[model samples]
Target: MGNLYLARHCKTAWNLEHRIQGRTDIPLCEIGIEEAKMNVGFLEALKISKIYSSPLTRGRQTATIYATALEVPYETRDGLLEMDMGEWEGKTALELSALKPSLYLQWIEDPRNVPLVPGSKEDVFTAQRRILSTILAIYKENDEEKNVLVIIHKYICSLLRCALQGLELNHFKKEIIETTLPQNLSIVSSQVIEKCLSNC
Candidate 1:
């Protein structure tokens, strides 16, 4: 198995506003730039075989910052794209919650049943699983990679948990995303493949 580093994008203006930025491309905030800079150690230590990232601005910015340390071209993978929230793109979670409380609740409690937003073409849950499958395929293909860094968004990050832990397919809380990261970008670190699934 290839080693994986599933990283959350650095914060953006929307992130600080507590607004939902599901799939709305936004640049990293200044603090996010600093945070991304601090991740240099993790990057240096990873000795990553290759760096992959979602195409969104936040993800791209984060990858570029990391690439400075890697001295390698960051590979953009659409497979790692963020979940498309459609009508809910720029609203805060609370704001959108008010607009679609029932849908919002279902999204959090169990995303599989969360209906597609009015104009979005894909279901959040389905998209997540598809992204995860793409990631797993990357993991499988990179048989010689010592470390594989996968830059993604919050929702897709939760999906990775399902892939690694066999969790029920659901939209799970932001904690799934937050906890995956350390307070300072330490979450979902570079772990040895053997150590990650020792029991297997």
Candidate 2:
């Protein structure tokens, strides 16, 4: 019954440029740093005691901001990493839509059916499984009252949101997850809960 708060990392250069950054390992941009700093007040309100972050620099850096503000320990977890975009790693969502309209539509409308790479299978299931397993382990390790923070990326966030909603991966588009810089969510017993967006 512990509180789990999931946050998407702050903005990045790739983010500013409208690029899809799945597993690209890009660092936070200046705006990203400022955004992370701004998240301190929001996280402070949540009273988080510990943070778990994706190993990627963006997630790590964002996690540091909240952990420092809350005076808590933070650890990086590979299981929290972003989804692998394969050939689409560096392309913008707009670019994908323009270059491969049908594929892009499939990605947006039914992500589980379309491969990130043109010819490969979609890895949504794998990403969801890895992230869920890690979140569950963390939930098990902590007491029910502790408020835990998890910093991660957009695609991974989508998968996590889907898992929390008790929906299949293909239904990801049905719910809107806040993916803007430093978006927040709450979890209890590993179940994701949608709270008021203004409060998050």
Question: For candidate 1, which ten residues in a row score worst on lDDT?
Answer: 179-188
The clash numbers for all candidates, in the given order, read 4, 0
RMSD of 2: 5.4
Among all candidates shown, the one with the greatest lDDT: 2
Clash pairs (backbone) in predicted model 1: 19-92, 20-92, 181-187, 182-187
- lDDT tens digits, residue span 1-200, model 2: 45677778888999899887877889999998988887787677777878899899998888887778789999999889887777777887777877745576687776766745563344666666777777777877788778888887777777777767666657666654545434444554433322211111
lDDT of 2 at 110: 67
**lDDT, model 1:** 0.68
Worst window of 10 by summed lDDT in candidate 2:
191-200
RMSD of each: 5.3, 5.4
Q: What clash count does candidate 2 reach?
A: 0
The deviation in Å at residue 43 for candidate 2 is 1.2
lDDT of 1 by residue, 1-200 (tens): 44567778888888888776777789999988888888877677667777778888888898998887778767788888877778777877776667634576667666766647656787765675567566656666665545677777887677556545645655366436652232222224224222333322
Each candidate: what lDDT? 0.68, 0.73
